[model samples]
Target chain A: MEQIGLSHIAITTGILLILTGLWGILTQKNIIKMIIGFSLFDTGIHIVMVGVGYVEGKTAPILDEAVQLKEAARQIVDPLPQAMVLTAIVIGIGITALMLAYALRLYQKNKTLDIQKFNDLKW
Target chain B: MIIKIIAIIIGLAILLMALIAVYNKKLIVAIVAAGVVSLFASVMYLLLSAPDVAMTEAAIGSGLSTIIFFYVVNKIRKNRKDHA
Candidate 1:
């Protein structure tokens, strides 16, 4: 009971984070604010991924003295999600940077940050 | 037991800060609050036993992203001042 509760708490937190980020993205008017919201969403997803991969009594996936070779397969927590998250984090940074660059260029072109004002594509 | 409590507390803090970041009237305040959310999230990552993810979140999400945001804000402010 206790063990299940721990992971449950973490997973719930992740869901809350995602909801907050989504709310920000939907309601905010500024481009930069939307970017910040996107980052938050990315972080929330990563947290959930890590939370889902967690094991109750297992250690990290590092092979060492405490986690011997033969028992490692059973004793170690899942490593695949962690590896994917690392890549995702870096990609998140790149995407944020790219979005910021777009914001800068848009500001230079239109001299405004309000999303409604830049509706050239709107029909 | 204690660890669970701590995680819950931190998670609540993250949610609160995120709300502040999204709804604050001041853009700078919103940006800073977002940075705080990222910092707390890195701590949550640590609790989840992904030291590598924690480190990445701390460095990229909290630190570099905030710096980039501030830089862009400053640039826009300076441009507006010059034009005004």
Candidate 2:
């Protein structure tokens, strides 16, 4: 693994985001906060994947004869993460929407957003 | 080096926002802080060169979620007042 500089930074940030998410989940009393924590955790992992694909001193994948397109392609950032992130993005949206719908239903039934006040599901 | 510094700042911002969301007395402030953290995370995603993830984070993570939470909060508040 050729790790240095920016890559190290990316890795550290990813770890930090995960830690923050964990803290949020553990400490927050509200359902919405938990959702936010989950999202943040998801985003952090996605960022780490993107960072893993980074190529030092590489331009984005764009074809142009004016520049050294072939050379650039040789050192180009990984396209797999780009593609994967697209999939993740859509999945995140779907999940968030579904979670919000559930939250709404929970609120409607309980009349409270506080998770502590919600004990009907706890059996 | 600069990018790493930026990433560290973004991470700190995320931590700060998460704290605010967890500890803020006002529900609205917490909600807004969550939105800000999502927005900051999206910016970090862009910095890490994930534009697609950044866009989705901005839209779904910050936008739709915040609005939904606000609506839910408003409903809860109104219902409580109705009982009082």
Candidate 3:
């Protein structure tokens, strides 16, 4: 059997977190709770990205005096996922803020955070 | 060897905290629990040799996001108080 490594552990944790967050989003009645779930989901995705990019026995993507240019690619983990996750994190925060703003507006209209209270769409 | 063990523990802790965030009865506790999950995930990122991601997660997840969540919660509570 292969030994456990950082990637294995991170990937597992990320997937579990995604599941937990999905449960929160699906079952939660409060809008705030759903927003929390969204945050969890976002974090989980980022973790997975970093995990997938991780290379065994590699240092961080940054190039410093310790590593030579020719060996930099072999010495460091992939930088692509890190870059993607960085952008995603910013977008996630923006989306979260937008959701919270919407929640506040909805609460103002109905004086309730409960999703069931706004039933205008019902026929 | 030791890093793997630490990762396992961190993973378990994140899972438990996430469950609490999802299932807990109290809103404040749930929010705090979610913040802890972010902090742990950041640590996990560091273990994965993604220091850049780890720093961003630590700053945004544990700091900015928590503050935003708390602000929203406080606003809702204050509004509720006014309505009642």
Off by over 4 Å in 1: A1-4
Better structure of 1 and 3 per DockQ: 3
Comparison by lDDT, 2 against 3, better one: 3
Backbone clashes (count) for model 3: 0
State the displacement of the C-alpha of residue B2, model 2, in Å, after optimal TM-score superposition. 3.0
lDDT, candidates in the order shown:
0.87, 0.75, 0.89
Q: What TM value does chain A in model 1 reach?
A: 0.94
Q: Tell the DockQ for candidate 1.
A: 0.76
Q: What is candidate 3's TM-score for chain A?
A: 0.96
Chain A only: TM-score per candidate: 0.94, 0.84, 0.96
lDDT of 1 by residue, B1-84 (tens): 777888889989998998898889888999999899989988987887778888998999889989999998899889889888
Candidate 3 residue lDDT tens string, A1-123: 147778988998999899989999999999989989989998898998899989987998888886789999789999999999988888888898899889988988889989878799988
| Maximum-DockQ candidate | 3
> Once model 2 is optimally superposed onto the true structure by TM-score, how far is the C-alpha of residue A118 displaced, in angstroms?
3.6
Candidate 1: the clashing residue pairs are none
All candidates in order of DockQ, best leading: 3, 1, 2
Q: Write the per-residue lDDT of candidate 2 for residues B1-59, one digit (tens) a residue.
A: 67767877887888788777767878789889878887987887677666666788788
Model 2 chain A: which ten-residue window has the lowest total lDDT? A58-67
Best by TM-score: 3
What C-alpha RMSD separates each model from the true structure?
1.4, 3.0, 1.2
